[model samples]
Target: MGEDYNPEKEDVYLMYYDVNNLYGWAMAQYLPYGGFEWADAKDYLTLPEDSEYGYILEVDLEYPESLHDSHKDLPLCPSTPAHRARNSAKTPDHAEDQT
Candidate 1:
């Protein structure tokens, strides 16, 4: 969906904001506990992002390189954490002590 997005362009500007409490902030939010019921997708689609209800959606996504340029500054979707083995290839962050 990179209609006119181009990260390689000279005039493009980027900014990074450090969200110190992003997960912590969301953890502190108010969430519904019960009374969840199935609703039609069409009806649920009409709800705004900041709607007063919580939802769990099953969506299929198509992420392409062109779309990366459009969303390079920020992600278009939230990342679902991947499960990996602790003994897998290690970057410095995960490397064992060299001592």
Candidate 2:
């Protein structure tokens, strides 16, 4: 594993190994935001080869906030008074004279 792993550019791998045998291993990649892309036991090695199994995990991840401002350009919902009130609060009133 390298420290240079960048979440934006690559996926992180989580490996499972049989501690007794040391040869038996399985791997999976972590999905963005949450969860993982798991590999089948047959894809790497059989789990029954050793009853004791352990995990070796490596992660490189990123979480970025949305750049779009939700408050900007919200369409007024005519059905809801609360929504109208919220939208009106955000609007600048020209009738109020600025000091």
Candidate 3:
């Protein structure tokens, strides 16, 4: 805010969603149990639609430099907890904020 900034003279827009029991609905989905096994490429490639064999897929990706100029302040996606943040000296999400 500048020296001439005024709260009453300005319009502050607050956008929000009114979702009830959203977390509870998501938690009601089927969850994995027991031990997990390393599946081969073929097993995952021809996985059945109803199967939760490869429910999650983590990709080692690089954010494009072309878009960095506009989206630098925002995190595009949730990063893996084990790997370090791209081009940062800070540790992964397990400890502290990458910022």
Candidate 4:
């Protein structure tokens, strides 16, 4: 029988493929500050790829093979502090300081 291949159910595992000998590395977007976000490779390679803008990956840090936190060396998603600041608007603290 031929090898079973299902794209939908299949998760493209990219690790140690020697694209650059960078172990557990992945492509992600880097925010202005200092953080990273992970993107699905399969989703990336889909028919309608998101190539409009140059979405880069965090190749410098190590990425875990599985989604689970098994390796400390591997890097995770960026923290939420930066995210909060982006969407939030605050008034001047001088008003509160006066009272």
**Per-model C-alpha lDDT, please?**
0.74, 0.44, 0.64, 0.53
Candidate order by lDDT, highest to lowest? 1, 3, 4, 2
Off by over 4 Å in 3: 1-15, 42-49, 68-76, 80-99
Lowest-sum lDDT 10-residue window in model 1: 80-89
Local error of candidate 1 at 10, Å?
Answer: 13
Candidate 1, residues 1-99, lDDT tens digits: the string is 377977667555669797698899899787889999987666776778677886887788888878876677788885745654544557876555653
Cα TM-score per model: 0.42, 0.15, 0.42, 0.18
In candidate 2, where is summed lDDT lowest over 10 consecutive residues?
69-78
Q: In lDDT terms, how accurate is model 4?
A: 0.53
**Scored by Cα lDDT, where does model 1 land?**
0.74
Residue 76, model 2: Cα distance from true site in angstroms: 34
Model 4, 44: alpha-carbon shift in Å? 4.8
After superposition, the stretches of candidate 1 with alpha carbons farther than 4 Å from their true spots are 1-14, 18-30, 37-40, 48-53, 85-99
Task: Name the regions of candidate 4 deviating beyond 4 angstroms.
Answer: 1-44, 47-69, 80-99
Tens digits of per-residue lDDT for model 2, 1-99: 589867677454465644673334333332245344564444234435343443333445443335223322433321346778776663245446443
* Residue pairs with clashing backbones, model 2: none
